[model samples]
Target: MGMGMGLGLGSNMQQNNSKEWVKDASDAQKGVNEILSFEEYVALAEKRPCLECRPSCKYIKDIFEYFGKSPRGDYNLFIKESANSTAVYGQQRVYEHIYQNILNFTEEGFNNKFILLVGPNGSAKTSIVRKLMEGAEEYSKCDNGALYSFSWIFPIESYIKGTLGFERRGEQKESCSSQTYAYLEDREISSILSSELRDHPLLLIPASKRQQMIDTWLKAFPSELETVRKSYLYYGDISKRNRMIYDALLQSYQGNLAEVLKHIRVERFAISKRYSVGAVTIEPQLHVDLRIQQITMDRRLATLPPSLQSLNLFSVQGENAMANRGILEFSDLLKRPLDAFKYLIMTMESRTINLQGILTELDIFFIGSSNEIHLSAFKQHPDYYSFRGRINFIKVPYLLNAEEEVKIYNDQIASLKSKMNFEPHALECLCLWAVMTRLRPALAKNYKDKKLGELVTTLNPLEKALLYSNEFLPARLDSEEKKLLKVSIQDVIREFENENLYEGKFGISPREIKQIIYEISSKGLMVTFVDILDFLNKFIDRKNEHDFLNIAPQGDYANPVRFIELLKDYQLEIFDHELRDSLNLVDDRSYEGYLIRYVQNITSLIKGEKIKSQITGRYEDIDHFFVKEFENNIKLKESPEIFRSHMMTTLGAYSLDHPNKKIVYTEVFTDLVKTLKESFREEQKKVIVNIAKNLVFYLSEVEDPEHKRSSSLSEEGRKEIEIVLEKLQGKYRYSQAGALTLARYLIKEKY
Candidate 1:
């Protein structure tokens, strides 16, 4: 038994000392293909060192580019449908600002500032940051978005397989390429010492020697150089643990830097906000704890060689520390005592933090968010000026466009893992109310001295929302007024930005609106527009507690209740139009055809060209009578021929500028369409009244509990109502409630 034990011990020792390293296919691929060597990393750094220095914005811009970007006045990309994604609506301007700032910061070396998003609660400040972090984390896992870190590959025989007889540690060999590390396949990696800081691999070199190497490399590629100082080359230091390991390896190698690098292993890493791999979120609390963590007194750690054991390597972790080399989000930044984060002034300027007397450097983008109340208070503080230059404040406000606002609720509804039915316009009703509460009346005082005053005075919140969305202009406006409104839109938006109380600065937040929807759904009641309206009405009653409720506008849209009434009136107008269409007695398609023919006739008359007549089936001179009839409806100040000539000139100029696009005549003469619709509505009034009477009879008969006799309709009456209802559903996308509402509106308006 004693002989057998001795033989077993000898066998184990032999295996440990002389075992061959059959390379792991997965690990080899990860190392050789996924990760870049020090030399390769340097080559990339020379061409695009911004990847290492400004990784946050670089990765963010990569995400932006991956999704794609649009020019300032173009918002189609921000709201386009994707197969598997919800469009990011209403923040195109914000995106442009952020993207442009990042470009300037990276290309122009504007790195001495932190981006701070300030807004009221629930204005998508945190949401924007969350998306950016998610995008960055997702991108970091890709080969194209690869980030790197290094580990000390110690020559411990028990952990390693090869390098049995290598006495000189610095015996370098020729690399396969000038951009790769020296060949050292015979010396397999053993103990991998990781770093929590994820410091740059270049930091492995001594400070003085690294600077000299960078200078020499830059000199070799003068064309790649820029006027901006390359301060980022020396941005951060190695973590204390890595520093200790590096020092120990250097000492063991008798102060030979090249020999020390022989024990290094380059690795590929991914960013994870949850694990604090490359991103982290910090609250205002005292959660930034950084203390020395002792190594576990387990066999693996205890059995370390005396050389490493003597170094007493320990790990430290904190919010800022974990977020090194990536992003650090200070959530609700101003919620805490300003003194707690006063070090930001220094950190932003120098990109370093004092960690228990050790000056730790960082290569991280710091993002902070604050509510308007806190920011307003912060602005009054004396220390505001002290931290001004280091911070760039971007205001995040509630969506001004009701259409865009509806998308928020729509997205939320789609995400709910529930199967509840929402009545059409329930979300729209809620969104519109929330938007109304947020809008500031166009301040006459601000624009009164300017030429935009008259237009601004006439603009209500609803009209302003339409303008902001670029959806539609006021249909009642004259051609000249419409032209002026379109031209001054940017100036109006700029005025809103400069307003003391910005248009979107005050409101019942989307969060509050979402909660109301949740409550309505949870009650198992029909989530109707009326129910949402009632919820908003009740919300207004709680104005004593919510300060935003007290923000009354200076126009007809002064109060939330008044705004709700205005919305109902607007809806009623819409209902009337829908009801006229729903009766299915008048043909709108015929009217549209007539309008198209009228335009063709006018065009031919102005050009003195012959036209084909649909009624006569003959080529004839342009119909002056039909053209004059449409022209009279337009109420043009110019004579009919002059008006026709002007329209032709406008169309000709438009066609010349937009050669690929066809000129839309209806868009140019929107008022004519409105006049036609109004004329058709007058013609259909009797049919609408008859339908309304039957609808009211149908509802009252079905709803009456006291009626003993059966409530019945004649076959012809039922057929008429059924045909109209079908048209309402199939053509107009109206629900049963919507049909009933429109019918009631028609009854009130016509009957």
Candidate 2:
């Protein structure tokens, strides 16, 4: 019976898995159909049409925005987050600039220029490009993101000499159409020809006659279709091999255009950098070859029509050929010899490259990345000025905000295949120290006013980090300046920018941090903040071995140990606050009740009227003593009536500012809670310190196994310690060890 039940369960599980698999397959097939003939494609295009007379850059931009949402500004399809899935941290400015340039190219046409991303090593230049290519590939598979290409269909009538038999294979049925023949036994079969370049089928029409044909076709269309027709009018010509096939087919058809068009088979295609389908990445290699091949030896070619059999049947293949109609990324484009890549400048401008003396037309967007060092060196080259116009340079720098930097680490940790324990703030502490190394001292001259100048001069790396993260403005600024700071922060960040001393241009890269994390985890030990700091200190010690570490930040930031201490202090402050809050020393409910009671009594005092008391069920005058106690708690030292009037006025102004929203007392009086917490902590200082000391003593006494000893506490002592322990664990969510650690740290600080 057990065996039967197990079999039944296994069978049910298999059925459920198969159902899920089938559903996924159906969903995948619904999005895109990968095959289509010329007529079918033209019909699809007519139904779902593009109405923009712009370059391929517009299409590229559209593809980018299709997969990602826009950033802050209210612009159409302007993506601020460029690193869609690649997890590039904190380079929104660079992404926005690159996006704007791509949009500019919609009006500029083919300028023979490439978007050159320049940054320091390990600054995620390659990551940005990979994300873009990945997005394009995904976008192409979507309905609105459709792209089309075609392959040649060579009829094979000569294979069996017209002797054919029909047979059924499985449940398949043969359908005959003008574009394709129905074949069962193979005598009337046609060999489907493939092109390496994946040329668009419309390119079969010669450029001289293509414009007139498109214009005549456009005239029959609705007025709304004009833009798409006009934009497509500027499409590139066919490849050399496709041109050869075209010439042979035209000769065989006796120059009949309609007959030649009959063999054209349009196929739907998507961008794939991995498969080299329309998206290609080229590295500097010894051989730079883009050539056409003749296939006269294949048995398939022998079966072709006599006109095609005698003539050379050609197909093009290479990096340049495969990347046609899409994107070609030149990785570390400047790493190659100048002579090797020099042709790009001319090819970019003319939209044509002379390959083996053949003038090939290219309708592709070019992108490349290079380290800033190489880019700087290349800028000094005599040919730099000539190539400058053909390149759009963008800077991808390390992240300035520690919070965003932490995101990079968090994402990496999430992607790890194995489970590893990480102490709280382990990643955050690393991010803090890493970001510190990247910051430059704020120059006083960058500010406009003397006060602002002084503020800028005193802007330590920590404060600058907070500013970059938009966490808080320093208290030194006035109310108006504080408001203005948020708007002008971006400008402040770029104020002292230079080729060598930019804020984010220098730092320990995320790659190194990831390596450190890996090394720590390899020991099979749980990683803590202290462990990470120790590893980082060791890494910094070997500064002479690595270039980036050797080039330290200016002044106080030059010492790695000092920076670690700063991070420690920051973490300690957070722990102290949590410790104080966990004690339940500040009663928010009590404070709110008192505040409401005071507001009521003061209202009565200000109005010179008596209020009915719920306690006595009788009318009574405002109790000055009761009101004064509430006032003293908040340190509101003024005339009680005036204080009450001021509170009402403050709420009124807040209501005006946030219309239609309820007035929140805590939000309006933020400093009031802070002041209350301070006062309460002072009142219970001795009690808190004593509890912290006793907890440390208890843990220390019981921690050892061999010397296990009783804590020797009275019933009240045990209850008191347990109360604080429960608050720490339940309220603050601290583990037993974490609670112990907090106790020890608190005892040392006596708070």
Candidate 3:
């Protein structure tokens, strides 16, 4: 504590997760709540923007931040601001492509140049953009020891919610998220003395060769090495501190710390590299003695063509790039011109905008994003077509090949462990959540594109596991208490098989299940496994049914044909009401009471502790799903009206918005009531009873599938619902509308 004065950063600068470079991302993100001014934060981020290579101009970001408003001086370019790290963060490999994707839109004669990135909520699209800006200030240094500065001297500005669709035609949509008008705001100050070198030029740089530029630029300034010393060993702030921490952390490590920092040149401030990129290492330069020279760079850039010549960067003032480039404006193309910067769907879509003199002919790059209208996202705006043929498509397909997925998994896990210094198994947990999230869209609320980095940084593995646990099992285990109950059911199997709790039959009462789960959890370790069915039969009183030693049944518990039938009979007697509610029991019982009773019976039978564990395997699943389907099973047999009511009612029951009270009998279930009345009248008592019994049996078996959707839903939540419907229709109902409606329900339930 008294060491604050030793570091000059003040004792307050003591290493925390955010300041820890060697720690995993989970650790780094723990201290992310610190309040920092936007400017300060961006500056900090710029230093460590991309781990790939040193950035161009360290001040390039400032130019965009302060004066990125002129649209080629003709139109406005709206540069988006991302709040989360993910918006701007990605694998170092993708960083260059992210830029290229946007830059490609600026190609010659391209129309609808703006980008419209579209995705479900929580997707990392915005995070990618954010990191881009954060690290945009500087790029890798040049082959020379000079720093490679990058900035869009073209003063561009955006109204976080402004619009510049079409001025003369008055054809523009309301800025969905924000209205950004990037234009070149002219200023006379110049960091570069030559007129041609005053403003910054946007150019392409390939990934492979970019590493060389980074080596050189970093060698020029020891300060930059502080941040990345750990990874790059040259310039990085956190890395500098990381070395000190590393000394403390790895003080006993096999590698010597003294040897590591021996050549770091902590004392000598400025150093120059002998050659940059492929060049040799240079010696250190003292302060003021080494001059800062303005020189032309003839570096080889892969993303760019041979035509480009000297590029300039302005330090003090924003330039007129906006004035010349004008605004990169776009109107709804509805269908054609799909490749235009179409990824900017977060804002400016269906709503109209009056772009009069505000926009002339706007030209800019557009990263095509799917602008397909989402009725759920925006209540089906009549003006916006459901099928917009606008924008080009860059296929980032679902990883179908198992080998491809393995590669992706390896990359994600490796990044989390190495870059973040996450604890052992950190990668495993991240991969688990990512795969689970992707495989169980219902659990992930239909969120596509698994971003392991985001999930790790946001929540721990235990929680993620818990969230996705429901994905493996079909039953909706929403509460921690209920999840524990599910676990108790597993424990019951232990008692049923090993102990003589019931009259020898698995008579599992809701109360006993609840008691065992609660009591066992207190003892440490939870009961879980397919062996749970054995416990359910404990209370059945299987006196003369069958021999226990014969044990070769396909299910967890089986007996001779007659004995098994008797156990089933007891199962029906005990779980009569619960079975009906979960199975779309065609009866007069209110869906609300039936659902509650069913949930209660099972929850009661299993200890709340086990229920909790089952709801979330690794951690608590606040937004993760334990059960995301099954309700749709009723829709497979029920009429449209009944299906809607059932889905809506279920949503109301579990929605965070409606978590305070029960919503079973609410108007949402009126259709359910109507359906029940009609069906019961048409069908005989035995048929109705059969449906009820079937519903109960299927509901009991519903569990989250352990895998995910590949070409199949075997590990999917849909099977639970299908299991219930099978009794009614004997097969899955493949109607497109039915699938759509059920899919909607699945999404709502999980998220």
lDDT of 1 by residue, 1-751 (tens): 9999999999998876655343454554563345445665667766755454344445555666765645645334345554433456687667677777777555544355778898788888777777667666766766557778775555546423443323223444344223122223334433456667777787776777766666665564442233123445443458777887777767876886666665555677777877887778988786543445656453445444456776655666777777776778899999889887888888777766777666666667778899988988999999999988888888888887788788777866775536565766667767777777776666666664454677677877767766776546786665556666777777777777855578778877777777877877776535556566666667778877778777655665657777777666666666566666666544545665676787789877766789987799888987788877776655555566655665666667778988998666566556666667776667677776666777777766557768665666666776777787787778767767556655655576547
> How accurate locally is residue 194 in candidate 3, as Cα lDDT from 0 to 100?
17
TM-score for each predicted model, relative to the true structure: 0.81, 0.81, 0.21
The lDDT of model 3 is: 0.29
Q: What C-alpha root-mean-square deviation, in Å, does candidate 2 show against the real structure?
A: 5.7
lDDT of each: 0.67, 0.68, 0.29
lDDT of 3 by residue, 560-648 (tens): 33333433333232223232333554445555664443343334333333233454554332221212222332223434444334454
lDDT of 2 by residue, 407-465 (tens): 67775676552656565666777888888888777667777766666666666676677
The alpha-carbon lDDT assigned to residue 454 of candidate 2 equals 61
Task: Give stretches of model 3 more than 4 Å off.
Answer: 1-108, 111-113, 134-136, 139-359, 366-382, 385-389, 393-423, 440-751
- Candidate number with the higher TM-score (2 or 3): 2
lDDT of 2: 0.68
